[model samples]
Target: MSVAGEGAGVDTGTYRHAMGRLAKGVAVLTTTAGAQDHALTANSLTSVSLEPVLLLVCVETDARFHDAARESGVFGVSILAADQRALAAWFATPGRPLPGQMDRAPHHRAESGVALLDGCLATLECDVRDIHPAGDHSIFVGAVRAARLAADPKAALVHFRGQYSALT
Candidate 1:
């Protein structure tokens, strides 16, 4: 391992290997702009502040949803429940059959017009506060406009060591 303060030795493979062991909740990030909807699976959701109800979700710069998010200035996050692994996988897929991925699943729109997936453990409608470039992704800082919890509670879907598991 490299010494602290020195950016040597650790490569992308090594970093990914280490981070892959961390358990993380999965969520689908969605945005709609110019009459088009986009969504992508992400595990990089986190609350940045509570006073303003701010949160952040990182989107790959190359993902289809990236431009839509930037243009829309609003997005939605649907935290997947344990049984929604298929939904998570579907959104994560690249070049997925079109007619739109949302067509393959049930979803609703937030007042801001962001698509919120049905059957999620929780959903948050957010307005983009800022965007920061980070490595190969862009971190979107959002202020939560509205939040909702599923009618029924269920275990969460988590990813660890390249696999999915239920947080029971």
Candidate 2:
């Protein structure tokens, strides 16, 4: 077993464990194709540009959210508040039945038909501008179609060391 602070190991297990230490803001990525909706817990969101308003999200290529988002050509990202850990966990769980998967949480539909979970600190709806395959995931570059930022200050739910933490 490698101890903490040990030499950097490039293996998959070692790389994953090392990345776990990096704190990332939590967000639920939502998408819909036709009559069905899909969502997944993702922390790979990053702001790429402000001019023209652009952002990116990395989704596992095999994830259900991926296909829906790809086919729909749009996606929604709801930045989770610290108090919304339960909702985050719910979407992250695999094998959860669909058609009513989003029923557990109250949400509203964006203009693009993507569902944005209510009570989030921030939300963004984007149209997929570009897609790049990266390893086992796809990097989706989105052009911000609509966005909302919470007016009041609040804590954000974060993920670190493979666990969720409220960063106050």
TM-score of each: 0.93, 0.92
Using TM-score as the measure, the top candidate is 1
On lDDT, the candidate that comes out on top is 2
Q: How large is the C-alpha RMSD of every model relative to the true structure? A: 3.0, 5.1
Q: RMSD (Cα, Å) of candidate 1?
A: 3.0
List lDDT for all candidates, in order.
0.90, 0.92
Separately for all candidates shown, the number of backbone clashes (residues 3 or more apart, or on different chains) is 0, 0
lDDT per residue (tens digit) for residues 36-120 in model 1? 8889999999999999899999888999899889999999999999999999999999998535779877998889988899998
Cα lDDT for residue 11, candidate 2:
83
lDDT of 1: 0.90
Tell me how candidate 2 scores on lDDT.
Answer: 0.92
| lDDT tens digits, residue span 31-91, model 2 | 9998899999999999999998999999999899898899999999999999999999999
